[model samples]
Structures are given as structure tokens and as C-alpha cells.
Target: KTRPVLDLRPLPKVMADPEQFPKVVTNLLLNANEAIQKKGSLIRVSTSEEGGWAVLSVADDGCGISSAFLERDLFRPFRTTKKQGMGIGLFHSKKIVEAHRGRIEVESEEGKGTVFRVMLPVGDGVREDG
Candidate 1:
């Protein structure tokens, strides 16, 4: 229904839990898709390196989170805006990111869009070039 765009950038491999990383990305992507109610909207995913962190972000031009929810309810277990959402997706995502000593960031404007970023510390992984 909407355009999907990816602008992934190369980064030195960061050590992360094999299973949990995918789960986090999956949840983010799912949310991006679910946020859009318009047929011509967009969902974008990107990756990059910032300072000493590896960043992964999912953004969507769709109905965005309310400030009240963003400030108080997000990442809290069982507090959901969706009728079907269990609300654990974000809650567990936060836990997993923190377990890796990472943090999650949010940027949203109601009626405009939302961007969710997961920032993780650059792990000690051997460079392939070397």
C-alpha cells in the first residue's frame, strides 16, 4: 500500500546477540508498517555509525504517537495504543537494547510521522579488512 525505502550504510560489525538483534529490527519494521493508514505513505529503514555507537532507525510517514503516550506509556509493559498490540514489543525491545548497553530514541509528531532509533555500543569485532 505504501512505498518502502531502505538507505542502509556500512558499518563495522558490532557484537550483538544473534537472535535479539533481528527481533528488535523486526518489531521496529512491523510498527512502521502498522502506523501507516494511507496508501501513499512511506516506511524507511536506515543504519549508520554515530560517534561510538551503531544506529538502526525505522521511520514512517504515518499517524504518529501522541506526546502523552510517548512520554508516559511507551516502553511500558501492557500499555498499548493498538487494540491488538500486547505492548510487550517495545517493552522487551527496551530491555534487550539495555542488556546490550544500548538505548532507544524516539521522534514523533502526531499527524505527521514517527521515527524510532535503536542505538547500540560498537562492540569489539574484528575488522574484515584487517
Candidate 2:
């Protein structure tokens, strides 16, 4: 088991539900953890601000998703390769992020790793005092 490295960069505030936003973070981290299949794997969580957006990225040096699966079934509910998975994590995550007017993206390569990025617009509900 490998501890995740966090690079929590300063980010502009976005309009997000305090209660629901943590679920997005938790689900992404949990999904990254479940992807690891061996010892010494690494998971990285990062935050940043880009072009008026607050970005949160979770990356894992674990089993990558197949290109076919990534295209067709990645966000479909109830479609999973894991024996214990119900395949709703990503599906639910997408709904939550989209509800916040944010977007989620992914990049993966077979035998390499995967990276998931969530970007939220940084304007509405943002405090200028900070």
C-alpha cells in the first residue's frame, strides 16, 4: 500500500456545495485507490487554478482502463469490471460535478496509469476577501 501524495495548490474559490463537494473528492480518491493492483503504486492529488477555473486532479500509477471501455462505458451506471463494484461512482460523480456547472475529464493508457481532472468555474459565490 502506498500513501497518496497531495499537492494542494492555492485555487480560486468556486461555487460548490459544501456538503456535496467532499463526496466528489472522496469518490475520486477511492476510485484511484481501487485501481492499484500492486505494492509501491502512487496516487497523487493536486489542485490548481487555470483560466478562471479551479482544477482538482487525481492521478494513479495503477491499472489503466482499456480504450474501448474508456470510450463506451466509463461513465455508465452499473457497468463495472471490478467484482465488488456497482459502477456508479463515476456516473454519480459526473452528475454531481455537472450540477455545479463544472466538468470532469480523464486520461488513461493501458499498462501505464490514469488521471482524472475536475474543473469548476471560479467566479460565482467566490469571495474576493481571500
Best by lDDT: 2
Q: Which segments of model 2 are wrong by more than 4 Å?
A: 38-40, 125-130
- What are the lDDT figures for the candidates, one per model? 0.86, 0.87
| Model 2 agreement with the true structure over 26-124: per-residue lDDT tens digits | 998887888886423899999999877899999998888899999999999999878898999899999999888888999998778899999888979
- List candidate 1 stretches off by more than 4 Å: 38-40, 125-130
RMSD of 2: 3.9
In model 2, pairs of residues that clash are none
Give the C-alpha lDDT of model 2: 0.87
Model 1, 19-66: lDDT tens per residue?
987888999888888889642289999999997789998999989999
